[model samples]
Target: MSTRNPGSLIARIGASLIVLGSASAFADEVVKIGHAAPLTGANAEWGKDTENGARLAVEEINAKGLVIGGQKVTLELDAQDDASDPRQGTQIAQKLVDDKVVAVVGHMNSGTTIPASKIYSDAGIVEISPSATNPIYTQQGFKTAYRVVATDAQQGPALADYAKKTLGAKSVAIVDDATAYGQGLANEFEKQAKVLGLTVLSHDATNDKAVDFRSILTKVKGEHPDIIMYGGMDATGGPFAKQARQLAIGARVLGGDGLCADSLAKLAGEAADNVVCSIAGMPLEKMPDGPAFEQRYEARFHQHVQLNAPFAYDAVYIIVDAMKRARSVKAADILASMPGADFVGVLGRTQFDAHGDLKQGAISLYDYKGGKQTLLTVVKM
Candidate 1:
């Protein structure tokens, strides 16, 4: 050993130190976040918008460099297509769980969100729906379920009130797509309409895929109600309104957030002017950081926000906020931290009540004029 060169031993030790430093510099953890929506069906526009929002957040966070638990972290998005089907939604939920995502933001429709919720609940993964407004979603005793938007319980009454007070409706007729969301919203609207002293003429059930609403419109026209409320998404609501106009139905069409989309004007054409709808949250233009968010989103995705982008964008930030507060990226840790979330992001202050619903939600009313969605008013709850 004495005969060996001391210089050689020093050189080997120095080389090992350099290697250790390099490894330390490159030590970064990759965290995955899951997003589910109907990326391939008629609702693909909305689904893709949701995905883009989450993806934007992930990209921005990575660029800024995130450190959690004293280690660098890179967020990855695991987006899946539910095709707006309940069964497909459950399958997607399970896949996200298997992928070990820390949090999930998605399932655009109530039908999918309700069934897929159990899967996320059993897996203990936090699911924050950006748009599913059914009250039953939070009624389930699953601590894992949460939503960012107002529920039909509030939205239905708001629309009904507007009809009675603003539109001065004495009688109303209702039509629903018969899906969970459609029927649920219609039920709430009917209950509130009764409370508001409005006469209910008739309530009709139509399939969500129904394009020809002449039969329903013919019957509704005979009722001569002042306003017609439709409980469904814009895809069907547009045609319903158009058909009502084609039949010269005198009543204006009313709908909830499901029908309050920018594409509605294009879908219904000239008939869109007869549509009045409510959104589950504040208008994007009125959000705290809405303008900036929309600008950034358009820059990144080259498309306008369809419906749930701002909510989805805020959802990712909320998940990360939980991670930072927990000082860990583990799913359980994030889940534990979600209850106390009060982060202010794109949609303004974010806080949840005992049932994991937004404590102070706001609803925006809109009407289409000349194929443009114009805001009427915002109701704070």
Candidate 2:
């Protein structure tokens, strides 16, 4: 010790300090947030967009560093593919629960989201859907079930009103994919259409997997309604519209948020020009940070924003905001604090109603012009 060199001693002390610092850094708690969607099916693009939105939020939070309960923490997204199947959605929900995720941000379709919601509710984990618009999703009275978008209750009527007022349609024929989402939306539209004094020529049921619509179009052609309302996702709605055009139905196609997507142009080709659809939230261009967010999203993902990416992005931030307010990373605490969430994100002021639905929702009406989505107007609900 007496013969020890000062430089060597200093180097030894520095190495010890480095080791301690490393240990301290490693002590950060790891929190898991589950994201479930159809990553390998017809709606894969939409699902991937949702995941990318949540992922971007998580990455940004990590970059800035996160501290909860006076302890540093790192967030991780545990994403799973439900394949757009209700059965698969339940399985994925249970798996996420088993994995102990503090919260979940998906189940893209209302068909999947409705069934998977029970699992999250039972496990006391928050299930926030970015795109599921079926009214039943929030009507189930599950405290954990929440959606950032407007429900079919409002969206369906808005579409019907547009058909009656804007399109001046006196008669309409309805078709649904028979799934919870498709059938539910069709039902709501029919109810409102009847009230609006628009004659319902006929309401038909189709499967979500059906590709050919000649049979249905042929039947609807016989009825010769002014407008054909399709209640289904774009994957099916696009083809339905295309086949209707091929059959010379001449009726303009109308659909809900599921039928509203940028890819609809490619899917339906020239038929997209005749399609009018409604989104469950405000138009992207009208969002508070829509332009900047769109640029950042394109740069990060190297693609255009589909539907619901902004909602998903805001959803992740909403969850993180809860975590910060609660000062804890526990699922129960986060869920407890969600009722009071008033985070102003890309979608603007986000506060939930008593039923876990957006307090003040807005529906955006759009139509395709020259293979591009063009906004018509925004209706506040």
1-381: candidate 2 lDDT, tens digit per residue: 499899999999999999999998779899999999889989999999999988988988899999998889899999999999999999999999999999999879999999999999999999999999998999998999988999999999999999999999999999999999999999999999999999999999999999999998999999989999999999999999999889988999999988899889989999999999999999988999999889989999999999788998899999999999999999999999999999898999999999999998999999999989999999999
lDDT of 2: 0.93
RMSD of candidate 1 to the truth, in angstroms, is: 3.1
Model 1, range 130-232, lDDT digits (tens) per residue? 9999999999999998899999999999999999999999999999999889999999999999999999999999988889999888999889999999999
In the predicted model 1, the residue pairs found to clash are: none
What's the residue-level lDDT of 45 in candidate 1?
88
Question: How many clashes does each candidate structure show, in the order listed?
Answer: 0, 0
RMSD of each: 3.1, 3.5
